[model samples]
Target: MDTSTWIGIFSVSASAMCMGIGSIAPALSEGKALQQALSSIAQQPDEAGTISRTLFIGLAMIESIAIYCLVVAIVLIFANPFWNHVIAKPGG
Candidate 1:
C-alpha cells in the first residue's frame, strides 16, 4: 500500500526469485557435469587423474555462479538500494 511497504515487498520477491532460479541452474549444471565426468573416467580409467582434476576445476567454476546469485539475493533482501530510497522519502 505505502511506498516503503511496496519496496520491501518488491525487494523480497525479487530476491526470492533470483535465489530460486540461480540455485536451480547451478544444481542442474553440477549434476550434468558430474555425470559427464564420471562417464569420461569410466571410459578411460588410466586418465582418471587428469579427468578428475579438470572436473574439480569445472565444478568450482559452476559453483561460483550459484555463489554469486546467493550474494545478489542476500544483498537485495537485506541491503536493497531501493529500500534506502523509499525509506528516505518524506513521510515514508
Candidate 2:
C-alpha cells in the first residue's frame, strides 16, 4: 500500500481504538462517581444537596476527557493533517 492508503488505514484504526478505549474510563468514572455520591448522600442527608451538586460538576469535568478524545478521533479520521501532507507530496 501507498502512503495515503497507509494513513487512511491508520486514521481509521486509531479513531476506532480511541473511541473504544476513551469511553470506558468515563463510563467507569461516572458509575463510580454516582456510587460515591449516593453513598455520601445516604450518610449525610442534610448535605445531600451539596454532595449532589459537586458530584454533577465533577462528573461533567470527568466527561470532558471523553469528549476531547472523541473530538481527537473525529479529527484523526476526517480532518487529519497528514492528509494534506500526503496529497501535497509530488509524484505520489
Candidate 3:
C-alpha cells in the first residue's frame, strides 16, 4: 500500500521476470547453436575442430548476455535505485 512497499514489490517482480526470460532465451539459443554446430561438424568432419572452437566462442558470447541480465536483475532486487527514493520520502 505504501510507496516503499510498492517499490519493493515492483522491484522483485521485475527481477523475477528478467531472470526468467533472460535465462530461457539464452538456454534456447545455446541449444540451437549446439545443434547446428554438431550438424556442421558431422557434415564436415575435416573441419570439426575449427567449427567446434568457433561454436564455443560464439556460445560464450551469447551466454554473456544472459549473465548480464542476471546481474541486472540481481541488482534490481537487492540494490534497486528506486529503493532509496521511496524510503527517503516522508511516510513512505
> lDDT by residue for model 2 over 6-62, one digit each (tens)?
998899999999999999999999999999999989999999989989998999999
What TM-score would each prediction reach against the true structure?
0.86, 0.87, 0.84
Error (Å) of candidate 3 at residue 20 is 0.6
Which has the greatest TM-score? Answer: 2
1 versus 3: better lDDT goes to: 1
Candidate 3 accuracy as TM-score: 0.84
Error of 2 at 4 (Å): 0.3
**Clashing residue pairs found in predicted model 2:** none
Choose 2 or 3, whichever is better by TM-score. Answer: 2
Query: Tens-digit lDDT track for model 1 on 1-92?
Result: 88788888888998899889889989999999999999999999999999999999999999999999999999998788889887878888
**For model 3, how does the per-residue alpha-carbon lDDT over 2-83 read when each residue is reduced to its tens digit?**
7788888889998999988889988999999999999998899999999989999999999998999899998997778899
Against the hidden true structure, what lDDT does model 2 obtain?
0.93
Question: In candidate 3, what residue range of length 10 has the lowest lDDT sum?
Answer: 83-92
lDDT of each: 0.91, 0.93, 0.90
Candidate 3, RMSD to the unseen true structure: 1.8
